[model samples]
Target: MQPIGTTLKQIRQAKGFTQKDVYGDIISRSFAIRLESGQHDLTAGKLFLILDRLGVSANEFRFIQNDYQATASELARSQIMLAYDQQNFPRISHLATRYAHSDNPAERQMAVLANVLIMAFDRREMVATPAMAQLWQQLTLTKTWTLQEIDFGPIILVLTVQKKQPLAATIRKYHLACERYVSAEADPFHVMDARAAFDLVALQLLLNHQQYATAQQFKSQLLAGETAHFTSDGNLDQQLSLWIWEGYFGDPTVAANRAEALRQIPSTRFKLGIDTLLSTWNKRAAAYHQRQK
Candidate 1:
């Protein structure tokens, strides 16, 4: 744990505030000195007053206290993203439950997205939860979205397709509106990220609809020059899963073998989950082959 007193002292020095300067209207200079020296305890109210004088929020103070790696909110978002990618349903559910009612708007939005994904992944025939239904309704009402919401495009599209939710038309209709919301021109990284998201979503939507020929054409475009251009592990998972579908009815063995090879590689991404998925696919493929023979 960081020493709060030391932290306060450092910030005071950085802000060019002497003990007398910080304590003028609040406490005595002697008390301030004692607080800074850890000779006296600072109450929460006094701490807030001091922080306000220093022009820092309690959240910002927490960030500094943690050595500035990431703010608490940021860490929570990362945890959710990692769990989502890993397809850890239990973890996702737990996170969704927590963030659904979070005071933070960003966290609440993430929670809605997580719940949507859970419905998609579950592939059940049940109706959407009232909360999820309302959230989706809100999202559909406007094309304007935060970049974080836009990043959800691919997953949302995939889930939409899987659930046969009739969103393809709406998405295409507002594609321009969606583009207007992005402020990526100033950031090349965001530019690439937005492009990748759109491409992945469009391709997956096609694949989900069993438009294999169309998906293949899109895949060709993605792999035109150097296929390695799309090296993200998530994209790799999508590609392999598509291969499994393509070969399933005929010679699924080919896709299964490819998956097995990928699983054996130490550098593979989504290692455990991918391996388990592939192992399961391989068994099904083998059974299909035996039945055919």
Candidate 2:
């Protein structure tokens, strides 16, 4: 990777920002010159502040510096998801802190989602904390949630239900919005991947609250819309959870067989965020027949 200062200077010049303009109280013009010349290195927080003033995200700057030329937010988000998949709490917490303090709302929302997912996975009793309520209101009111942010919907859904909030209609609305998002995607792979992730989340939330009717509704719609793409080849956590859902609301025989199959698979295959849900699903499956009778 090129020196951060060199990369910063390049981006600043490309943006037509003079040293004074880019420095703008964040640092002295001399400091900027020294930084660019590799004569000095700034602290992480200070570097981020300078980058913020330069109108370039740290992720974007890093990507450009590394010659990746990819979307920075997407790359960071993917890394966060991979951390969740690997059950790396330390990494998740670290990234959550980094993105939570980001100037970008998209990244901030993602950080909130990660924190909530971790809590949900750890089975922390969900109280309507001020932060939770604040995030809930923001997500509910904001129309900017798209692509990656769409995944945050499920985390918020689980939070709302666990907190005893009224959001059944909101849940349905989010599911519809996800459908629209998938429909608008140009790549079929992205569409199927998005839908599988979406359905997996929606089903997990609904089942957690014993909202079998709504779960069934989404399952039916998902099948109708993308039944062919809904195969075992999708995300493993999702596939296992979907099978558990099927057993809960569909034929017990199929669900039991699937759950047994799931049991044989290693728990490491699942996302940390979904482990609590998976455990709950299994426990629910065990008592489902008793409730029916």
The model with the greatest TM-score is: 2
What TM-score does candidate 1 reach?
A: 0.54
Per-residue lDDT of model 2, residues 1-293, tens digit only: 88888988899889898888777788888888899998888899888888878787776787888876655466567777788766677888898888878888767766766787677556577655565677777766777556544556557666667657665665556656556645432433344555566567666666666777777666554454544444453555455656866767778778767766766666554534445555777787778767889
Off by over 4 Å in 2: 1-66, 69-72, 88-91, 97-107, 127-134, 143-145, 162-167, 182-189, 216-218, 227-238, 260-280, 291-293
lDDT of 2: 0.68
Candidate 1, residues 1-293, lDDT tens digits: the string is 47777778888899998877776778788777777787887779988998888888887887787777775457666777677656687998998899888898778766766776666545445365665565566666655665555666655564456446765454553344344544423332243334444554465445435565555555443432222333465356445545555454435466656666666667533565566556655665466457658
Report backbone clashes per prediction. 0, 0
- Clashing residue pairs in candidate 2, if any? none
lDDT against the true structure, per candidate, is 0.61, 0.68
